[model samples]
Target: MEEAALLIDPEEIAALYRELCQFPSLSSACIGPEVTTQYGGKYCNIYTEWSQRDLERAENVKFCRQYLIFHDSQSIVFSSPSGNCTEIKGELLSRDSPSGAQKAVLRKITNSKGEEKQFLEVWEKSRKVKSIELTALEKHGQVYEDDQFGCLAWSHSETHLLYVAEKKRPKAESFFKPKAPELSNEEELTKAERRDKAVKGEQFVFYEDWGETLVSKSVPVLCVLDIESNNVSVLEGVPDHISPGQAFWTPGDTGVVFTGWWHEPFRLGLRHCTQRRSALFYVDLTGGRCELLTGDTKAIWSPRLSPDQCRIVYLENQASGPHQQCSRLCMYDWYTKLTSVIVDVVPRQSQGEFTGIYSTTLPERCWAADSQRVVLDTAQRSRQELIVIDTLSGSVCSLTKGCPLGSWAILTVDRDLLVARFSTPNCPPKLMVAFLPPAGKETEINWVCLEEASPIQGITWDVRTFQPPPEQINPQYEGLDFEAILLRPTQIPQTGKIPLVVTPHGGPHSVFTTSWTLYPAVLCRMGFAVLLVNYRGSLGFGQDCVDCLPGNVGSQDVKDVQVCVQNVLEEDPLNPQRVALLGGSHGGFLSCHLIGQYPETYKACVVRNPVVNIASMVGSTDIPDWCLTEAGLEYDQAALPDPAQWTKMLLHSPMQYVDKVQAPVLLMIGEDDRRVPPKQGLEYYHALKARGVPARMLWYPGNNHALSGVEAESDGFMNIALWLIKHLK
Candidate 1:
């Protein structure tokens, strides 16, 4: 380990980064293995490996990435490789509906492979009809598509529920334009005024009717479909002007649905409400009546039923003060209709401050496996831990005390505590199971290997010399020095100097942790020195650190990257001036800003769906207005800067900076994206071309904000890989 620390080589680091990048197989492995219970047997594991021969077998092996786990029953189950947004559907039913039985379909659409793969497993008594085999069905006038990204949700029960609420839209026009508000005086309104009103008024359209109905239309629906019984009816009609965000089913399998919606401030008129509103409604299945569960709760998430089905478990969110810094978790009783604050997790430092992101303290419904206890993994004031609260006793115990906190997923089993987690600064994640000895015994965690564990220590990494930052760092660091992990190559470099790739992550709210397998290591192996800094505004450090990065603090994150870039160049003068900046989402925004403002520093840039104009992004993107307020962007029209100020924003926009860029650029976008919509990419690409700059843009027609799904289009994969190799080399 000592020799490993001291023997840093620049070329080796670059090589390591390159090698890390070559693992197309690595991306395929991101979707977690299938863990399912076999009949009369324990849970089984299925892993996927990328084979070169398989590449030729599939239409587009690069885009044909899926982890297929065939169960004993011949049921194939696996997640997509991209590990982003995807719809993974499996059929537990027969190919066709039974002669007289309703369909029990198993379908899930999620962001897995950086895009959404829609999985459909229709359950029939004797056999299951899998959608993956539906290519032949597409010819039969049936088009079954799944959207794993943004607002892609399924209503529980036999009811076909559709909750299309009005959220934010990306910069693209994949969907219908927003409708203009209806004028009370129709005659008084001019033709132009009516057209504008139609454009601003949001509407809703079924997926099948995507074109006829405007994309901005938001109509919430809940329907019951029992083909065998010849019963297909819309259970309840959603309120016309308001969007219904989320809905859930009753345990009795009735059409009864619980729904909620969230509203943000507007750019003009009576916009800029101090706090957003979220309301919960219970719709009776038999009767088309919806009664308010509670009058306008601040926020609610993950409504689950108790074993008896008398009560419900939901997360009640409310801000402590105006700036929305404080947060509390409360429970609402369905029978009594009473709500009470159950947990106060927000720190005192954030109590009343008009400065922070304390939106949801816990992940969404921290309900336990058995529902008798609610578990919360919090790192608000200190390191993260698991706090289990017994509903009956109302007592809270720290289940994961002293455990290194990272993102955690709870494993459902009998009386056992199993967590899927990765420690800090690591790239790979691990699954660990702990046994609570009987009722009275002490708690002890035992490591279980769902998959073989391979820490960075077990893998080979390219080492590069790091020029350390100057002494006298922030005192917030306490006594710890900013540590460095160097990778060295096996052979000396003959090339003049190796290139450096600085890949920053998105989520000014999220941090880079040391968990399991990450792509940066591959970049190092590919012969490029990669530096991943957990800069300011990164989470897990503390609330204060995260709060510092919003708004202009984003520049601080960039500043930190600049210092690291200079440090690497200084330590290894052999390093070429061909440094590149790469990032996605927030990181993409940073990359765009960096090259735009400091074009001389970085050679080439690869930005994915970046939020270019902060004000426009706040007004248009899918993030909440409260989040914008916390970031110091004014919500009111009066507070907003004049269009002249927007010129300054345009200056920082990647589109404006293309003229000064010294290197080639690649813009990747998903057409259907709602987050940082595909339009942002399109606009930027057009701007670059207008400047006669060397720029290329690749768009995934049916893709969304995150390219979370895999497309069986080899053309898409090669486009990006070829672009990088051509420009980087």
Candidate 2:
């Protein structure tokens, strides 16, 4: 057994991850001014990609390339077949721009020592130095969208910049808090205040999201920088209750429109609670004050103002409910201040399953060139579709239709056309340009490929779909049918079934789209068939399906996943005896629940940032309401849960099945995670250890619930691959 484990070549697994990471994963993109004839292409200048020769080098030492433009609507590979970033020539504006002809520059560098360093150099058109700067749009702690890279914008003229920065560090909270006078001498404090400060040492800080994400601990200071004048200003008068994000400049540069969370800063626990109250606000730059645009605390996201500033359209819930509220496209008239529901997108109309806006984060460039329409990314039948909704008529139309089994997003919007990046279940992201139809007609969007096939290409990705039987419950909310996407080798010999790895996405409210995923793809390359089930309680299936898992997260979700896995094992070429379970977040919670309940079924289990103990998590997690809502108890943010509630929560948690786990389990956790709390995974690890179940654990320091940080995520991904490969093989 030991020798077999040694032969599992971790380098190969790491290479696969590194190879995929090398592709510039384009998310938020902007359309450039002109389609230049240079390189016979116009450029979309800035993007994020793997930094170095491999994943480690890219994570530790990476070169930030300014722009990687599409060369004449043709797909091109930027790296060699063996996965090396190939240096290519471009007409990019650089400091040494003396030559009228484009020049070749050093394109790649290595960081063998693993030193923490970054290089930033700038020069004006004349190539001269200027001593000028702002307080830096940086923060003392992690920025709000560090993980998903959220809410970054450039003005219409691209001069002034607005971004979320950690303005200042907050003071620690004490059991016996002190109240300061309105007017006090800064030089001299009262004796009692001085004594209290001297005796107290900072302990635990209360957070509502991941660790150190408290708005009070390090508030998101809205900073605006004037690049031309070198003047920086921070917007003031924002109520202490609100934590602002997803901000963008309004038309004519009058003010900034942002999604603001109005919560008691003293009781900062709802920042990550999606069901919590949130609204839109306008920060008057000239007056230095923030005005509430939407007075009601409705869950709102991605407020895209029209080019004419006539209407501000955003995604909001039709009903005020916890996580599973039906989502709708709302347009607020700027002149009359009247709000109207443009479309009722949820409640599963049966005709459209993926019409609900992906809602978590809307693309920055959602508005059309005409501004009479808005383009959005929606989940339909487990696949991502980029649809444009007409503001006047409230009609929705798909931008494209090929491979509805994959994923798609509009990165840049130019006039009526869209520059989108998408991928299939087997393909990587390919940038293309598609257009919306004229006023009342529905036209199929023909995508013009911006770049060629991916750098690491040529592997055939075989993908298919399977549906599990409806739940054996009442027709109302139970047994709403769901689907799972299967991926494996394209060419399989007629023989025993391939090893199966069952995966469920996190966000009991989130669904697994047919997008290309690194983990599942790599596992498939490792000769295993992967199953991604968009089970009960997942989005895209509508509100009824989404609402199904909340009060029955453990039971309902576990059963759906089991049914899907059994279906795959029974019909497909999947090895039932070698089946394994993989998931993270709530997905991890379900993984643990599955292993404990059906202990003998799974041969191995791997979970990252899982919730093992809800009783313990309820006390420390940022979203305490999650514990209550998922456990079948109503959440009252103001009231403490009773003992009976605690008992029920414990029973609902995976802890109840600790004694029944028979699979060899591998646990991965972020030490600084505040969502589930590191203690949640640690407790389960120790419990399994004490029970003599074969268990191993890995913890990434300073990582939150999304353990996909550069180094931490790469290591965690490789280890998970190793663990699953070792056990399944």
Candidate 3:
């Protein structure tokens, strides 16, 4: 048995965390870039938001700024375009009119007493046109901001604004509360007064909302704001059970087109789950009628209208099984009301072939100037690549085929030009722009970098493919292969062997691309080799690979991770004895499984909000369907699982082998987590403690499953480093 130190230096952990905080990351970039005249030349202005750790606040502070990339008639200038801007408060969503003459901004203001108010402000040129308070007493409830049910769109005619907000409901009050004063004979009661007088004691009524991170978002309704009269009206004709979102003005401003998700069966966690049952809907305001655009499809998202407004292109997925899968790109003709699949799901792909689209959503504005081409980013193996699809011919072309080893994501498409962000595991993100080449000439794209790559001093990385042994491979997924990104330090240790830290991503359905990640880079800089595994169920390899892990979790995933580590150890200068594990959520489940199944392989393990017991988790997790489906069983929320089903779930859980775990474990739990309840980690901690095993647990209040609150993440990472250092030695 390996001996571990009982104490670790807190100052050492703090210093290392502070050093890691120096790397700034790009949080988000605006979709459209504006061309402006500056210094007697043409320049492209891109607004990007960045985040960096603030030790004083114990959280990340975001900075929204503009990047000015210079361009000329003859050539483009490659230089740093980083600049600064002041922060705005209470801003929820904002959009500019198609004519660029006016802007609409939505803000939610709250007083010190916790009272909230929503305001919609319209600005014309440099002057404020009007500001209207959208009060719940007179209008709807809070405006929807979650991606699944949020939109702020301007009509082409610029006469109205369309947005999604919560449907209004009567206020719940206590029946025994104080009564209202008697009205005098001269007093006149308005409609609002009359409605307020009918109070009901329904404060304890239960209403299920879209789970996890979407609090107070039960029902979303389409709202149209008439700028001329400043009157907001909730659109009718849509089914009462449907929640509308991603709305846009239809051609001729006759009505609006949006995605409607069914809430009848029950609302599951929507943040990363794209398999929700939904369809494209068109609401005809003039006729007061609603029409289903793509009734054949089960799930639909991001309905983007072409620049010519003749067709709508969107992504669709299967409505059942895994939370995510390869999506099919489909287009709808506005005139004929016909829908056709442009790219179907790819079940298998050979090496260097086009894997199916794994991106959850497309960029806001992705249409090319020709209106026949659409550009988007998707996962291809271990990296994200940008591709352009010709809507007319259905021909797919990779815009980043011959580029350097990195990930490319489209920020926005401006007519003939495309702005993208490129980054590698060692290099920070750099903004770049390229002109769309003529048809069949995509390989000749000339990319001009707006920001130079900032590479970390001692960090370097490469993707390594691993194959499971023939006997260990699942026959159904024989065509699938997994990958691990090995990030190493340039300066080798004195012993010529590096300690290894195996990191796996949370989403069993998610993939870890060859993109810059802070924690792995920090570990590499601290003389540790970090291996990020993309196991069989990870997205981007094809649909078959994703389908392989449903019934075989804890076994297939666990073996693939072991194979990856063993392969890396054989090919690289890594110390097999001094290995540690780091993961969160499903990844954390794998870590716990690996430590217990192969107790001698790892010396230390750390998990964040890990799923330890699936049987218990099924009752508390926001996505109960995930629990049943992943266990290779059917999901019927109304029915309770029998004894046989509970046994199967437990047999596939990490807690089944808890007694075999020898590695010291550190658990980081978010007290407010809804996806994977904190009790999951607490139960495991107590079990390990009872066994007299070395274990420690950290509890974070006001944090969710991601433990992503700035303070929580920072403090968690520091403790993780300390734990690994103390035990790995």
User: Which candidate number would show the highest TM-score if scored against the true structure?
Assistant: 3
Model 1, residue 708: what's the lDDT? 44
TM-score of each model, paired residue for residue: 0.61, 0.80, 0.94
Which candidate leads the pack in lDDT?
A: 3
Colliding residue pairs in candidate 2: 45-66, 45-67, 52-58, 75-451, 75-452, 76-452, 354-379, 354-380, 471-479
List model 3 lDDT by residue over 638-697, tens digit each. 899999999999999999999999999999999988899999999999999998889999
In terms of lDDT, model 2 sits at: 0.66
Q: What is the C-alpha lDDT of each candidate?
A: 0.45, 0.66, 0.85
Error of 3 at 658 (Å): 0.4
Model 2 segments beyond 4 Å from truth? 1-18, 35-53, 58-131, 136-160, 169-217, 226-229, 265-273, 285-290, 318-326, 352-354, 454-471
Q: Which of candidates 1 and 2 reaches a greater TM-score?
A: 2
Clash count in backbone of candidate 2: 9
Ranking of models by lDDT? 3, 2, 1
lDDT of 3: 0.85
Query: In model 1, how large is the Cα lDDT of residue 371?
Result: 54
